[model samples]
Target: LDRNATMKTRLTTLTWRGSASVDPRFSAAMLPWSIADIRNHESYVTLSVGVEDGVLAAYNTDFELQFEHKLRYILGYCRVIVKQEKGKKNADFLMPKATSTRPQPITIGNDNVAEIFGPEFGLVYLLKNPHDPLLHIHFYECEKYEQVGWVSFLIKAMELGKCKPSRH
Candidate 1:
């Protein structure tokens, strides 16, 4: 098999599991009541990379699909605004706590995708397409633990996605 075929196989089968937590600083600023909340409050999450409906996709827990973007090598440079999944609540709270301000969108490039995973308040990811100038994925997390493994998995996913066959 060619290299692209191998990469496509790996990307479609890649899966990683880990827990997410709120960053103490962000939590203190936004959800002061949760300051005492234990790290990794969400317990566990599973993320995967795959192709759906002919587009490269990222799947969150329970096989729920998130962002979909074209492969950079196939589509050339482009820009896509990563949006939150509909109906997905941020954190476990019934409603967002009252705050003077709302969360802001974070802009990231291919090189900075991993940084999003390390933030204290939000979960962010980079879409597989490197040519996208504004590609990013963002979500809320109170605290995160076992991030080293998560990062490793994500990096591998990104590498695999880069080499995925264009025909898919």
Candidate 2:
């Protein structure tokens, strides 16, 4: 075999075996068994849209969805306040003003609070920022966050081959 092909085979063989130096008890979850088949150059994996939706539902709670809905509602009517300074250049630029409609108090659902899984942060429910996709708020334990779930652009991450477990 050529040098590149030989190196690839060796790497795949080593990855198929559990680590030599580490005990199984100390390790976290193992890579899904499909990794072996997926390593083949001609291999392809097919996932159904319904299965994808179901998995998303399993990780998301009703409260969290409601929270996102309310935030979206408030932001829909939001506008930036631009005050013109006396001596500033381009101070006359027109800006959107807040709606005249009275602002009502937003009452969120019970899931508005974080579910504590540990002494400090056991579970982590992330709220994604509307303006920035990469930013999010963690609701539960920082150390044990993944025990609950993670917020990520799964499709984007997988497309870029960057979807490994972040903490581990």
Candidate 3:
């Protein structure tokens, strides 16, 4: 049995499911995570990222607008996991399979940055910057994936220019 395969199966088992009612209190608590704040170019986006034992995980909610002209809303969770390799000073990212029926092991090394973006859930950028020496993650919520993609592209372009100094 492959290690990555086993890890993927284990992660799928940790799926969270539940239901709740809409209330003004709940809405008030989540207002900070709204797409409007991201659109306004907020300086900081708050997300929960933590490490326990040998596993590092980040979790966030994706708001999906439904019904006619965004009258209704649905919520889903996106989780990213990275497991430390035994005896090695590197970790492997665990990418979730698109569907529950198929189990595919997709893992990336720590050196490579991993990002997940969706039309509903927003974007998660995972990277370690040398200047900070800590895990740097930038999350942005958008009603449409196109908006996230556009911003991501611009950020990447700017980063490239900064790295090369003459590529602009």
RMSD per candidate (Å) reads 13.4, 22.7, 20.3
Which of the numbered candidates is closest to the native, going by highest lDDT? 1
For residues 1-168, write the lDDT of model 3, one tens digit per residue: 343321221111111111122332332223223323333453443322222222323333231111111101112222233223474422223343544666343323232323322223344433333343333233434444444344333334334453222211
- For candidate 1, lDDT tens digit of each residue in 131-165? 43433322323233333334334444555665333
Residue 67 lDDT in candidate 3? 11
Superposed model 3: Cα runs more than 4 Å off: 1-119, 156-168
- Candidate 1, residue 42: the lDDT equals 45
lDDT by residue for model 2 over 4-65, one digit each (tens)? Answer: 32111111000111111222232111111111222333422221110021122111111121
Please give the TM-score that candidate 1 achieves against the real structure: 0.26
Q: What TM-score against the true fold does each predicted structure earn?
A: 0.26, 0.17, 0.28
Compute the lDDT of residue 128 as modeled in candidate 3.
39
Each prediction's number of clashing residue pairs: 8, 3, 0
Query: How accurate locally is residue 7 in candidate 2, as Cα lDDT from 0 to 100?
Result: 18
